[model samples]
Target: MLKFKTMLILLVTMSIYSGNAVASPTSQVVKDRSYYEERGDIVWEVPTQKKTIAFTFDDGPDRKQTPKILEVLDQYQAKATFFVVGERVERFPEIVKLVLSKGHEVGNHSFYHPSFQNISKEKAVNEIGKTQQAILKATGHTAVLFRPPGGSYDQNIINVSKQNNLQLILWSWHQDTKDWRAPGVQRIANKVLKNVRNGDIILMHDYVYNSSQTSEALKIILPELKKQGYSFVTVSQLLSQKDNPNTHIKVTQ
Candidate 1:
């Protein structure tokens, strides 16, 4: 009994040290996009026949990068979604308002950009509530869409979002441009131009650490995608048309 107890303690120590003890990604269930979307708990991408894609920019209301990205979008007559950080929205209200005024949609990204899975339920609620208040105060538009920081979420995050009436949104698995990594202009452009499909929610960031390459990548992506017969739409617009009876949904791998 003593030897068995000693081995169990050693194993527990090893597990903790290896970081295997941390309960993360909270939801244990691994399912497809349709499962979450149908339940309305989370939405990664919507099915559609309009050939419309939702381009969502996170961590924004950036003073410099945002306006440049806006210019690129305007050049193509594309409509996209900007998921604005709460504090940034507060500091750059005009930028948030400009995003709305420019025929784009703004969604709530948490105030401090903390991963919801890492925080407690109370703090998670505060993060969503405060950000919602900030966006509404600044843009005079309530955000109906909420994308968790770093795409991190748990049941608590989902519950709080439903209580607040915000749709929890995520990007298509294939359409993440990873612009925040500053993965080079060509690579970012290539990710979208190559993998893009109807109903994809493309992820790009308007506010990245230090300088942003996203605005530059957009110059390459937007025109080529437009030529490929793709039109960008806000996430809400994509969701609205997803259930249209006349629309034919495509098979996704």
Candidate 2:
């Protein structure tokens, strides 16, 4: 009888202790971010709502890869945001049309994608303004969002973009496939599948870099994300879900 009682006491103790350990981390995070004001180099998501995610492609509107990426998105009926380089838009105007016609969105990625930190303010405006012109010319729509090349930006970069009436955009999280180096398709797919969550802004390239692997990974990831009950949306749409007060970041102009 004493042996059974001892075993029961140990099991009860273990369960209570384990629950506390598991619950403490979440409590700590809630405590930390409660007073934190989201600012630069920040990426976040709301926790208290339905599952949704945004997929954004940067440095794109490429001749080869953009079209293929579009085809896949069409297959899944997924909408996305394409941050097109101005020079690339000039080179592939039809790709821009395809992106717009399909009800996807286009944003500014600078005309030449130069390092915004080093360029003079005048040059910076030119880089972003030229792209805005190209996008408007191609799709008859002006981009409202701008993502600095390599995500390198500062107060000056943001100011220049806003002068052109473009909002500065950066991501909350990444799968970090490094697909530029031609990572394997399955490996890339697995990485995204394992990490993707609601309100995530997944970064991928729609240009000609590592086209095959990116396409293959898309084939795998789309179905998997769907299986997890996530609806794919553009970045703008993701930002529009503002009623879920648990959002990790909010931009107030």
Which candidate number maximizes TM-score? 1
- lDDT tens per residue, model 1, 79-192: 999999998988999999999999999999989887554578788889999999999899679999998876766677788888889999877777777677787999998988
Off by over 4 Å in 1: 1-34, 243-253
User: lDDT per prediction?
Assistant: 0.81, 0.70
List candidate 2 segments past 4 Å from native: 1-48, 243-253
All candidates: CA RMSD (Å): 5.7, 13.5
Query: lDDT at 171 for candidate 1?
Result: 74
Q: Which ten residues in a row have the lowest lDDT in candidate 1?
A: 15-24
* Reference-based TM-score of each model: 0.85, 0.78
lDDT of 2 by residue, 104-181 (tens): 999999998786534676787789888999999988998988877665544566567768877666554444455555
TM-score, predicted candidate 1 vs. hidden true structure = 0.85
